[model samples]
Structure formats: C-alpha cells, structure tokens
Target: MDIIKGVPLTSYILLCSILFAIGALGVLYRRNALVIFMCIELMLNAVNLLMVAFSRYFNDSNAQVFVFFIMAVAAAEVSVGLAILMMVYRNTKTTDIDALSKLKY
Candidate 1:
C-alpha cells in the first residue's frame, strides 16, 4: 500500500513546476503587497514540495532536513515581512505597491 510508488517522479516535478510558475505570475501581476507576499510563500512551498518528493524518491533524509530549514526560514520571513508590511501600510494607508514609489527619496 505505497502511495508514492503509484505516482511517477516526472508527474511530481511537473506539478511543482506548474505551481512555481503560478506563484511567479502571481507575484508579477499582482499589485497588492499582501498578494505578492502570498505568492512568494507559494513559490517557497512549491520548492519544498519538490525537495520532499525527490528526497523520498531517493530514500534520503538530507533533503527532508533541508525542507525543515526552509520551513523555519519561511516562518521567520512571514513574521518579519508582515511586520514590515504592517508598518508600510500604517504609514502609506495603502497596500498597492505602486503607491510606495514615492519612497524613492
């Protein structure tokens, strides 16, 4: 009753690629800072998924450990990123990235 054996590695890779691409597009097309941040998280998760998939396929714990580190980094990033975004929003009163262009000074 092994689930991983049923799914090919290529399929996993393809799915990861598609997810990563969607995340990238979201970041590029969305003007809202929150949405962009979410997209970045999506991209990181996609990579994590790929890493886990490969790790499992190769029967290696190293990739799993790497995934744990990535998750930790992502958590820290979320906290710091949200804090910064909150401060920016409080000052600018807007979440639109284009509105922040005045900060070039």
Candidate 2:
C-alpha cells in the first residue's frame, strides 16, 4: 500500500491511459478473434488498475470490492468467450474477423 501511495496519481493515470490506448488499437487493428479478445482483457485490466489506484489514493474500499467483481465477471467471460471461439474455429477453420463476417448461412 505504501508503495502504491508513494507513486503520484498522474503516473497511474498515464500508465492506465497508455495501456488502454494499446488495447484499443489492438482491438481495432487485429484480425484474429483471440487477439481481439486479449485486447479487450487488456482494456479491462487498464480500467481495473485505475480503479485500484483511485481506491488506494482515496483510502476507500468500495473500488477494491468493485474490482473483485470485475475480475470475477472477466473470468466468466473468458470461459464463455473461449468456448465460442473454439466453436467458431471448429466451424470456419480460421479465427480471422473477416472470415467470421462471411459466415452467414
């Protein structure tokens, strides 16, 4: 806690912003579904980091609780998302986003 408090708020904000930007760019530019999914997780992690930083700075436990909820939800999402991705790959033989776009029967 002390280590986190030692760092300035601006530093955390800047780090989160950079992480979010990278995740956003990866989501937008990557063609593979897995890569896009990873980017989405990265974005979520950035938000979580910001939340935890603010909670630590403010000496509040609410944001920390919310972060746990977010992490649990993310875990469930990963299971479901990976199942869907596996099904898509099994059907289309490719994980390309463009390939999925052409999957209309």
> 8-78 in candidate 2: lDDT tens per residue?
89999999999999999999999999999999999999999999999988899999999999999999999
User: Scored by Cα lDDT, where does model 1 land?
Assistant: 0.95
lDDT by residue (1-105, candidate 1, tens digit) is 565567899998999999999999999999999999999999999999999999989999999999999999999999999999999989999999999887598
Segments in model 2 whose C-alpha atoms lie over 4 Å from true places: 103-105
User: Looking at model 2, which ten-residue stretch has the lowest summed lDDT?
Assistant: 1-10
Q: What is the C-alpha lDDT of each candidate?
A: 0.95, 0.94
Error of 2 at 55 (Å): 0.5
Clashes of each: 0, 0
